[model samples]
Target: MLYIFDLGNVIVDIDFNRVLGAWSDLSRVPLASLKQSFTMGEAFCQHERGELTDEAFAEALCQQMALPLSYEQFSHGWQAIFVGLRPEVIAIMHRLREQGHRVVVLSNTNRLHTTFWPEEYPEIRGAADKIYLSQDLGMRKPEARIYQHVLQAEGFSPDETRFFDDNADNIAGAERLGIPGILVKDKTTVPDYFAKRLC
Candidate 1:
């Protein structure tokens, strides 16, 4: 089986509240106001799709939040979204690779978040045979074309691949292309999934 894993909330734990808190501290914006105003809108989508530059996205996001923050401050708070690494899934992916399955990552993320984590969590860089990011691909999750692009680029058969993501929409997107997707709910989801089936 060829396994395609998602980065956020699956291999790495993330919390948007961290961003709000960090920004609140930096910009003197109330947590409630930040939470209420922050949006995953077109700017965010464009960032993930690699259509918008990091500075542009950050500026747009700041505008949306009505935040007064310098680039350094915004970046600091933006990066705070990452909580920690989840290597439990990585270990399983390595084991699966040993058994002749291909492992790769397909994440809808941008350079803002991507630049920070890989250095901190080396395993994240090595967990998969290939890591596909939307920022580079100009394609994000829940898009049929992105899935098609990865499968075609990797030369993997859709029927033979399994996609694991925390988002149901992304899973559904993969499913539409005949790829069986697993909805990863928590830390144990992937480990538990292969626990009995790892023969």
Candidate 2:
């Protein structure tokens, strides 16, 4: 069987609070308000799927907050906060690769966020036989079409592949396509979950 994993908040740690802090100074809006915007609109999704360029998205956010910072500064600070990997998760990925199952990554992430991933995490880099970034694909998860894209590109029948992701909605999307998924938890527990029959 093959294993497919989602990147953000699954293989990597995402602290939106840091992002909020960086943009707050430029937006002149309270971090809380910015978070509300994130929750209430398509700002984040649009940015992730590459519908909005970084400059445009940052400007829109600045306009929403009525802040004084330049889009470049806001975007730079927003991108700089993430650091390191969950070592245990990395180890699990390596273990899976050693077992000879094909491993792949499908993430709904923009170019800015992905620019450093290949360098920051080389082991996971080696683990994946193929990497599909949403910005590059022009598709995002929790959406059926993106999942179908991976299925088609990788040539894996849904039944032969298992997906691991942190979001329930994305997991459900995989389920809808007849590709089973496991909601990621502590890395230590994932192997037991996988051993029980994946897809």
Candidate 3:
């Protein structure tokens, strides 16, 4: 069987609030304004979809938020969104690997995250047999094409694959293609679900 995991909140801890707070402190921009212009705007979607270059995304964010920080400082705050890896999740991946299951990562993340996450959390770098990022593919979760692309690229049958994601929409997307999926409600839910299924 093939096991596909979502990076954010599934294997690693991600808190957007952390990035927002850091950016607010560094740029002295109002949190509400930052949320409105950056977090809640189309720029973020475009950035995640690889429509914007790293420099271009940072420039757009700074312009929208009136940030005073240089690009380097802004990048740091942006990368601060990642907290840490869930060790239990890594252990689960290792266990799955030992049992001869193929494990991989499918995440809707951008260049800034793709650059720093592996460095910050080496487990993520080594855990997956392959890592697919939406920014690289120009598609994100909840998109049928992205799911199709991954399944085709990996040559995995949908019926034999199991996917886990924290987002309901992403899970639904996988299910639409006949991949059985588990919605990870919290840190323990995934481990619990897998424990039951794998045992």
Candidate 4:
């Protein structure tokens, strides 16, 4: 069976609050205001969809949030959102591979994250048979087309494939394609969940 996993939260620990706090400190923007203004706005969405260049996205974010930080500083804070890799999840992936299950990653992430995560978490580097990113595909999760795109491109049958993601909407999207999905809540519980099912 083809087992698809989401990157953030599912396999890697990410906290938007960490980025918000860092950016707030750097930009001198109040945390609440920063959180409110620097949302998944149009520019952010465009960046995730690979429509905006990295420089343009960074500049747009600075302008919108009235951030005084240079592009490099902003990028640094942006990439700091990821805390660490979930080792248990990596172990689960390894076991799944041993069982001859095809594994891959599907994430709604942008260039900044894509650039930093692999280097920061080498444990998952080359772990997946394929990695699908929203920036590269011009599509994001919770959208039916993205799931359909992966299913078609990888020649995975919907009924035979299983998807794991932290977002309910993304899970729903996979279900819409007739793919069974597991909504991952806590990273610590993932290994046990998969063990019971896949063992």
Q: Pull out the clashing pairs in model 4.
A: none
For lDDT, candidate 1 versus 4, the one ahead is: 1
**Sort order, TM-score high to low:** 1, 4, 3, 2
**Taking the tens digit of each residue's C-alpha lDDT, what string does model 2 give over 27-134?**
567878877755525877888889888888777766766667876778666776575676666666677778877788889888767666777777768767788888
- For every model shown, the clashing-pair count is 0, 1, 0, 0
RMSD of each: 0.9, 2.9, 1.7, 1.4
lDDT leader? 1
Candidate 1 local distance difference test against the native: 0.91
Off by over 4 Å in 1: none
Q: What is the lDDT of residue 4 in candidate 1?
A: 96
Work out the TM-score per prediction: 0.97, 0.85, 0.91, 0.94
Stretches of candidate 2 off by over 4 Å are 25-28, 185-199
Q: Which candidate would rank higher by TM-score, 3 or 4?
A: 4
18-64 per-residue lDDT for model 1 (tens digits)? 98999999999899999899888999999999999989988998998
Residue 37 CA displacement from its true place in model 4, Å:
1.9
Alpha carbon lDDT of each predicted model: 0.91, 0.77, 0.87, 0.87
6-98 in candidate 3: lDDT tens per residue? 999999988988888898988788888878766546777788899998888888878877888788888989888888889999988988888
